[model samples]
Target: MTEEVNNSAPDNSRRNFIKTTALAAAGFMIVPRHVLGGKGFLAPSDRLQVAGIGVGGKGESDLTGVFSSGKSDIAFLCDVDDRRAANSVKRFPQAKYYKDYREMLDKDAKNIDAVVISTPDHNHAMQAMAAMQLGKHVYVQKPLTHDIYEARALTEAAKKYKVVTQMGNQGASGEGVRKLQDWLDAGLIGKVHTVYCWTNRPVWPQGIQWPATGGNIPPELDWDLWLGSAPYKPYVEKLVPFNWRGWWDYGTGAIGDMGCHLVEPPFRILGLDTPVSVECSVGSVYVDEFKRGYFPESCPPSSHVIMTFEKTNKTKGNLQMHWMDGGIKPERPEELLPNESFGDNGTLFIGTKGKMLCDTYGANPRLLPLTKNASDRTRPKAKRVPGDVEGHYTQWAEAAIAGYGKIELSSPFEIAGPLTETLLIANLAIRGIDVQRPNANGKGVSYPGRDMKLLWDKQNLRVTNFDEVNQFVKREYRQGWSLGV
Candidate 1:
């Protein structure tokens, strides 16, 4: 029900900048693998120079992981909030710092061989796109982007710009996903038809109204820049550092936060694509005993979303994928032992021949029925990243050094983007559940979009029968912000 339109960036100049930079970077500035052949031939100075945007929290950890790989130099850091960047700045004392990412990219484009982005969902597409347009390889934290259009655009841009790209769903690099694949391939699970992924997230507040009054902006934060692409609004307590996940403008809610981590396994195992249909049922909060409140601005407290994808060669029939979040979970599989624990964050796959379960990041995968044959069926046939999950960062850093397509990436945009689109498409149904219309007799409000299966036309990116929810497919950015698609 809310829309913001501000498309005022100078088109010609931006396109020219991207084109010129991409042509100049037809080859990587980072030393290729051949240049690092032997111990004596490669100097410490030959490491790829990586600049990090939004270097705090996960960003700090991502940068550390890259540097720890022993293949990259942490050359620059950028974040709008000085407070959040403090830990990363101290950690990388030699790295130059900038408050604005655009400033950082503008000044250091030539010096940086690659960039890592761990900003909030809203800023992800723009920052990553800008880095790619400048012909730098990129590593972005997952859910890829806030919207489906952004995901698709970033996917295509990675190929067009000829840059190495990785989304931070480190789970994609985990052995668990590989094990599940091996089990499936070994004919242990037959063919996967249904998947249930659940999480106890939105640990932050949701299903509430925005604050009616604005508070004083914090000294350490740049409010304007933090609201990049999102409509400008006055500051509110506890929105920064975290908690932005609940708001539609800044985040894609729980699914966005954890879908990349949990849903990724199924996407890879099943070889799924954009969902053909999505349906949802959400938990509601009551203002009083008699009244239930609908807060469209925020995500619901709990949701159970089901998405269907047409049959692929790997799937036996149409695939039915279920996503539950905000503490909701699927029924315990009967095959699971009564005494065994169902992980708070985990995935369950019900295949025609058998079943399998796993924990977050696709770790701890085990065949169901609490039987010995589950673990006995398969040995790994797939390649693994050296450090397993932690290797996700180094994989990208090494790939950046190796140049595009020289090395394989586990969660490159081509894969992660489509996976992200599935999650966001499910979100369309989640958000649509709250869509309001004039009640009969125009007395008040009614949820016209609830409890109905929503059909998706992937070709056009629309809700074929439900026009109201199509607005979310691609959001209108604030003035001066665009995906530059």
Candidate 2:
């Protein structure tokens, strides 16, 4: 229960007045050529004024799905929990609420434009890198960042604040994950190798029990901005309005709560990058009675993570991916169909030619051994792919007013920041035995230690194993709340 690492020092005159008013609003920004020629387009009487920042539980279902997808207009609502920002200001009575999202981005930086953060995950890379350095346009949710150098510094501040980003792994804009990425890009599962993907999640909050050591800190909640950048613990409603997803200094457990929606459709129809190694095997162990939570009654209220992707002669080969959560379920391949039921949240893949499954969030995905190899007939029917047309909160309100139109955003932080740095490196391999010690599965347990299996040069994000886990790839802020990279 002691994480705290902000290293402060930002606010360089509010970061150069949000970089000179987002470079003078990107020099008069007008690239909305058509999409009804912007200026509040997505029509329902052209809305989109939005500003939300963690507006209570699933940010109040992503602000009622972007104001019922009439395409936005919530105005402002932030939250460090004043009764869940007064229940989103009683369903946005012309909202203007704020409990400090840096004082509602210093008093509505010219009427928000777009924000919607859905916080907690250690204040998601500092409120989506201060709303993409104030040009706004962000959606952010999923395991976007709670380390791994703030998921590559919020994917390079959303490509240097050009903004318009999305992450709330809303089953990657379903339609069964675009027909499971067009059945793994029309190969109908040929290359894939081994991919599993489970999730029962803590089923509705899991087993890592910890919360009983005093109380009294709920005068409507603030507790230091809900323990803002986390660390100075004490106030505890079992760690906030929704048991902070199993907690590892503030959520990222249960493999960062369903590893970006069960490891995003086999990491985007098998394009998986970075993972020449990673190993985890847990179950049985207890007595860390959860501090800043993240199970440890010896470990394994449910666990099994075995990642292994290696194929860098320019990818498209060696893959392994297995990951199972609480109700653990993998090992059902006799070509499936025993009345087929890879349910309770899903993903399967396992191909050389047949298998692929789906569920939990990606809804109905299929493609099992419907028949082909040495056929008894019946396999020719692969077409269905159009999912989330104007869905995932109107695809982030039509990419915040006409930007990413052909609507493809599902966990886009260049792929949810390396799938949240490989599920927060499995919570640093389940707290790498509190940083060295327990190995033969004893203290907290550990693995992936040939110096955390090196190899991740993603261009130059570093770690060919630079002296072992390169200080676990970033973290040491906590002064005025650093995070500038």
Candidate 3:
């Protein structure tokens, strides 16, 4: 992170002035992409100039997807860890590499037309917002942001800035989702009332105390930059690269990791909006033989979250969606044969007339009762992405090149924001399970956030009944960093 940021920047005041000037110029001076050729038009030779933040692991694949579209030029690359970034750097040798995103944006905003972000959950909102503020189109990995407030902010920003946007829930563009939509629209499922989505996640550590001892920092890693916007703490072992998902400060736990893929089928088919209420029950860990472990900073190992969304035109009434992770699953649907394989990760939709099930990313969609697969359910009602799930990347890149409103997107921030909020709201309930308060006797502590359903004030972005959980809705960034909204 800091490895590539060693060159000293100008003094704080001058750096701020430069940043302000650069962003202002980038926003106002750059010609709007949509206006060129009067919407949905790009010259054949024109290619999107993309700057990739977090160009490693998922970031690598994401950029590759965009580049493979034959409509993008990978102009710049940024990552906190040099080791993680090596592959991307080698793949696009000409793309300038930087460890600090702010530096790249500040210096190269004019050179970048769009940005592809695949950073950790904690860094997603800030980086995406910075790019959007500079009038750069963005494709961000899902759950769109780490906090509900951040999601709401990014959603609004996408509109205000008038930049083309897409979330990295590639499943949204899959044929299975469109097929499910067609079935639901055709009255096959008959008003989905209850939806169950489950995944075997939290493959990383959770429900554990932070290590008391600090681990030696990797030479190629910059610990401070990796902690962007998060509160300062010494680097610990096995936390970088992937395990950050289990920590509340850096990740959004299992639901955040897989909820977008699993919950998406019912969400899109039913046209869901911000959930009105959410409740969750999480597995507990015992510190010893008696006392249950209370690691407030860590997400629970297992959780069952239920979110209640207001009725949409596609549904008969309000819909109740359940999300389970850490290997916990809902009761098997009775319609299936006992020997049928219930996927390890899948989504099940229960409606008034029947039921439907699909694996992760809405793949292998099938109507329950097993025999329903014999009938022709394929309806070309919903348009399919050219390459299905893999097309998600090119879809965004093309829409970005064609300009906003020129083409439809499967999961723009407008959709991803609320969808992400649903997950984060569930997390509020999960984290609420550990909120400490004085006991009735005023001596020991109690967990008041437990056992109560959290009511959401969607407009206000806060919990109505429980105030303690609201603290998580928006977090203060560490000094010298801002959402830049």
Candidate 4:
């Protein structure tokens, strides 16, 4: 299914360039993807040509899902780390390889039909934006972008660019969410008023200071490219491969990593929106016997964030959502027997009548009471996504090849964007949990923002109560990297 790359200037270069320039000057028009083809639109039989950025780890899985769909070909692979890309390269030897996505997109945009991004949180926006501007369909990893502004921008861009888009919260395609919604539809749980989502994440380091000494850079890794959009920092050993999830510059803490998976069920089931108010209490770490570790650069070891959302159609009143991470689990419901599992990563819904819960990826959904099993009358009302979670890739590929509005997706940017915004907002509250304040008594320190309830102005993307933490709303990109571009 691989197509030969257009090494020379194609006849459509001028037209393509004109379209792209116009998009940059005034966002983009909502032109259909099939507009390139005459009449009957794009054929459903056509294969989607996919290019992958960050083609390692989760990125590899995403590409594999696309290939496994039997309706797409993996045409290009890009990654910052050759070591990490080795498996995908071996798997898709016919696919052309590149180390920098910017280079790949610039040289091969015409050859690519869609782009999949699974890089660290910081790089998601820039790479996805580049692809979208080129009129390429995009499937970005969960928590969509590193910051709130990026999330909003990408959300709008999907509409403006008129391209098919999906965020890699594959859980949205799972039957678990459908089952949960069925229970809600059946009134089994009544009206959900409160929700709790938790995960035993941050198996990596957090609440710790950066290493005093930088480590040797891995030969296969492009350190600078890997730090795209994030401020430069010398290489450190454990930070590579995965531990980056714990740091602020690269990761969005544990919540950013798992919240998209765990919190999504509640967000979808409850139809939640931006939180009006948020407050947080985080677990601290101590570097010495004197004081608690205040590694402002790292996320807290654990946290409990409480956000209140205005009532939605699915909710009865103001919705209270609690997020817990770092092995923090909520009190087990009385219906759950001592032997029953509460799950390592899960979401729970508290309704006016009873409560229901599920594991990560919205799996293993169950109602309250140790014996409350699904009866004949408790059939699924919502249709389950075909092929379950992995279908997320095929869904996007087909929609891209078939044009906009062709197929319904589980976690499209429209849905994933708001979900990501909520999670990032929660991060703002977490980041502010211990911001140091200027104390007149300079003997030691003071946390004026400690335990403060942050009032989020979604339209402005700021913490109204604590202004200092608002800086995180849309962080400044490092020199040479721009999300707008």
- Residue by residue across 1-485, what tens digits does model 3's lDDT show? 57445444446568899999999767654565455443223444469989999999999999999999888999999999999999999999999999999999999887788999999999999999999888889999988999988999999999988889999999999999988888888888787789999999989999999999999999999999999999999999999899999999999999999999998788888988878999988998999999999899999999999999999988779999999999998999999888999988999999999999999999998888879889765667988999999999999998988887788999999999988998898999999999999988889998877789889998898999999988999999999889987
RMSD of each: 13.3, 22.6, 12.6, 9.9
Candidate 1: deviation at residue 321, Å?
A: 0.8
State the weakest 10-residue window (summed lDDT) of model 3.
36-45
- Model 4, residue 95: displacement in angstroms? 0.7
lDDT tens digits, residue span 200-291, model 2: 77744545555667588877777787667766756755556767666666666777777787787677656676575565655553455653
Per candidate, the number of residue pairs that clash is 0, 16, 2, 0
Cα lDDT tens digits, model 4, 331-371, are: 88888778988888889999999988888899888888747
The model with the greatest lDDT is 3
- Where does model 1 exceed 4 Å of error? 1-45, 373-377
Comparing candidate 1 with candidate 2, which one achieves the higher lDDT? 1
Error of 2 at 138 (Å): 9.7
Candidate 4: Cα lDDT at 218: 88
Error of 2 at 130 (Å): 24
lDDT against the true structure, each candidate: 0.88, 0.68, 0.90, 0.86
Which pairs of residues collide in model 3?
1-80, 1-222
Model 3 has an lDDT value of 0.90
